[model samples]
Target: MGSSASKAALAATTEEPMEPGPKHLADLTQYINETHMSVAHLADILSKKTGSSSWVVVFKALVTVHHLMVHGNERFIRHLAARHSLFTLHNFLDKSVGEGYAMSIFIRRYSRYLNERSLAYRQIACDITKVKRGASGVMRNMDTDRLLHTLPVIQTQLDALLSFAADPDELRNGIVRAAFRLLLKDSLRLFAAYNEGMLNLLGKYFDMRRSQCRESLELYAKFLARTAKLTRFLRVAEQVGIDRNSIPHLTQAPCSLLEALQQHLASLEEKKDFLCPCGLQHTVTLSIPYRPTGNACARRTWFADYFPYTIFTLPSPQACWSRAAKYGASIETDASGGTNWQLSTCASTSAIWTSVSGPPSPHTVTSTMAFPPLMSPQSLVSSPPGLMADELELTAWAGQQSQSM
Candidate 1:
């Protein structure tokens, strides 16, 4: 009998442990319930430590939900749901600084932590529906698709929050809400604008137009401009991708396309007659006729015609002569003691000069002169100096006149 008892004891010691059954699962559920309560209590303490308006509450709750969704199975989710975790979330949502904004944060966190194919997503979705329905009867009536449709409504509310701010101070104070609004606004608009149908249409249009015809080129320019605008807005959308640091090269696409179109139009043989979308030809000329006196010392006056949307002005014949004399001193003179000076003007394509003759009709000789590069529209547009306030005034006046026309 002692030998048999020893053998049985040895067999028992060698036996493998049995798998956990219903009793173990019940214990696990109890443990999860206790853990969830502890987390809720901690969150309440933290919320009291931080102000109710503080985003910390929202962040902490999001972390809790993420943990539960990622690690907890269906039974754990059911336990959380039974403990009214959704009600806690709903209460937090109500008191939060931006309710819609907070919801978006929750959605993004859930999407990041739980895979759609996983049971956790579906469980969380159901719990979210329940919480949403409890808060609003409208959500209770909604099917899953309809419930998902409310995401845009929340997005629109967040956008309205951003738009309604009177100044930057309001946005500064609500940085979290502002960030959510900015991040969502561009993405929503871009996705709506660049749908599959629009893409297919654009592709077909491109394939149909291969020639350099004016209509085709005009359409191409429009397409490029639209594409550039959409692409620029997509910067925020692309931030949500796995590689956050990688920025798309299309940020400056509009500027590049404009420059390219300008070059292409300039290269065309019929460019002279082609009226650009900007309502100006490739080359624009403004002539100011002036009469020159026999006495080279005399200050000849010329009236400048106003050039639309340009800072260009015709210099007086005396000014031209002064510039010529200044430049001519460094150069060689011809046999007739006449000096030719090459003048560089601010206008991309303008020249000014004086004509002197010894015979009759020499009194009113026309002179074409070029001004300095400093006075060009491009330079003024780029960096208008304090001394160039008059030029800016002229440009503004010209712009008003053109708009009125």
Candidate 2:
């Protein structure tokens, strides 16, 4: 009996766990319907509370409907298309064309209005309260009054302009095409505006040298990267009968702004004299016990140690020549008629050497470093193991250096 019980327990332990099954189509349909009802109910409550003249309710309803249409299942979408005659109307028809154009204009104006109001609201919110002693004059109290007074007025005006019905009769007429067009246009404009606003804010913060700008920039970049993935999902939506092309083209302003900011920040970071918040300038320190010579191997070894944390290709022959020329060094004949060369320190050379060595000190001695003659790329590649091992050592050293940093 004991042996049999143990066998059963082992069998139970070895059994594969059951995975959750996919949701049933009926359950999904019910869920979508319930969500739609919830949004509709919320809109109704808002409309009653703020009055039928409030645009806030209308806007919320429109956004909810657009979300449902965009993300809804095929059955619900097909029902909508058929019920609304969305794609059946010909653009050549005078009524259809006129309504479509009117819808586009209305949407554009609405988007502009929203943008202006949002900016105004932000400004007002920032400056509504002055520093004061009284309880009534407190910032929080002032904000509450601002919200109470401003929101109802804005909502009323907005609602009067574009009142949304729970069951929109506009959808049954030729206006459905116009409605879809407006939805798509508005969505694109809002997205563009959001990106533009972020770009402007980032620029402002960066100009002020605010530390918070870094976090904001990173978050914005991450959002953009995630948005790129949405394109694939949109393609799938198109396959399921939604007209993805009806959406307006995304503006490149945000991407361009991000790229420019990234490049600017990178350049700032690379500067050796860039000041940190601690009130000290950043500098690379290289300590070499041996003096630099004309030999390529010695120079390569020095560089390998100098840039311990970075992996970079060895300077080409032309680059070496350029550096030498910048330092006013040249090959010439000596008084004894023998080949001779002299090197002097230039700004670039001094900066480079300073970065490699420790911070400047009173006792620091300046020595004349020899510049190596330009060698072909092939010779640099075919150097001895001792010289070649510098590159290998660099790979290992770089990892360790990075960990420490």
Candidate 3:
């Protein structure tokens, strides 16, 4: 039975006329859902197909995997998330023809997207996900600590999805091909989910005066860097003949919020007291139990046996925004029990914090061979409600299909 499914997958992907088409894709998906052995056998076949030198095989194999992800059952998803998964299409390449060469680029991008999508899903299945989805179908008002762990992963997925725009010419060459059409639709759903996720996270930091935090600021900067990337992506979309109106998510990405975030980041960077050496590289001070000498300071710079608890230098002045280190005026208490502030006698040996600009991202994504000037309710793919995965749960139950590989 396993061998049968493997052979069927190979034939459907390699021997089919043109693309596998919907019939074959549905048949293949059924095979994945049949049994554990069938799932493993099918996965092994796909890994081989995608890794082949033949571009057609790679494209068919990738499409099959994408279909399985969307339409197959849970077994396949777990198979992918297992410690050892089958496909290693990340560095896949094909040099058979001009179209293959061009298509190879998107193949790599797609593979990376799949790999990231799988891992993020695994994070949720494992309950290791820091951010959880809210009722509005997007990640919002997340715990700050969890955002630190989850935000970067979200950015990475966004970058992978947006990067599909990197070489539109190659894809343009495949525009008439089915793989192009399939990926285009898949990318649309992806854009809607990820773009909404990025925006909601930005919403967390929308009010700088109230929501200011080093972690949130870092997130804003990360998304801000993609400004240029977004521009390139849109250019490719226009070149591919996609109807802008048909795809509101791609066309109406949260640029205004990104700009607002950038403005806030820049404003902070511009402040004289915003950044300093001590923030990144602070002096090592002794804990309360250690002697107050050489890299050691009293808890209050306590006097008597060690030093007085009330009289001590405030932390040296450092960036006001830096959350990692504390450097400011010395804090001490006088006889009346009132606190007094003074400048720190000690200083950092070197300066650290400096201006570094985030690279811009073009909202690079393509859709359908030719999106109608306007889409109807039925024409639009309803992104699954589960795609709201705890916000960073990323794509909700987006990884609906999972089989053992």
Question: Best candidate per lDDT, number?
Answer: 3
Regions of candidate 2 where Cα sits further than 4 Å from its true position: 1-186, 198-206, 242-245, 249-405
TM-score of each: 0.20, 0.24, 0.53
Q: List model 2 lDDT by residue over 1-405, tens digit each.
A: 323323322222221221111232223334455543323332223223222222222332233333333333333333332332221112211233344453334333433333333333344432111122122222213332333343333333233223221123233332233333333332332232233333234324334232343544454454343333322222232343444333212111113224333433444354223221111111211122343443434544543333222121355434433443443332232344332221221100101111021112222332222211111112222221111111122112222322221
Question: In candidate 1, what are the lDDT values of residues 172-275, reduced to their tens digit?
Answer: 32333323333333233222222221222222221232233233345434433343333333333343331222222221111122332333334443353333
In terms of lDDT, the poorest run of 10 residues in model 2 is 346-355
Pick by TM-score: 1 or 3, better one: 3
Q: C-alpha displacement of 274 in model 1, angstroms?
A: 18
Counted clashes in each candidate structure? 8, 6, 44
TM-score for candidate 2, please give it: 0.24
lDDT of candidates 1 onward, in order: 0.29, 0.29, 0.45
Report the Cα lDDT for residue 279, model 1.
18
User: What TM-score number comes out for model 1?
Assistant: 0.20
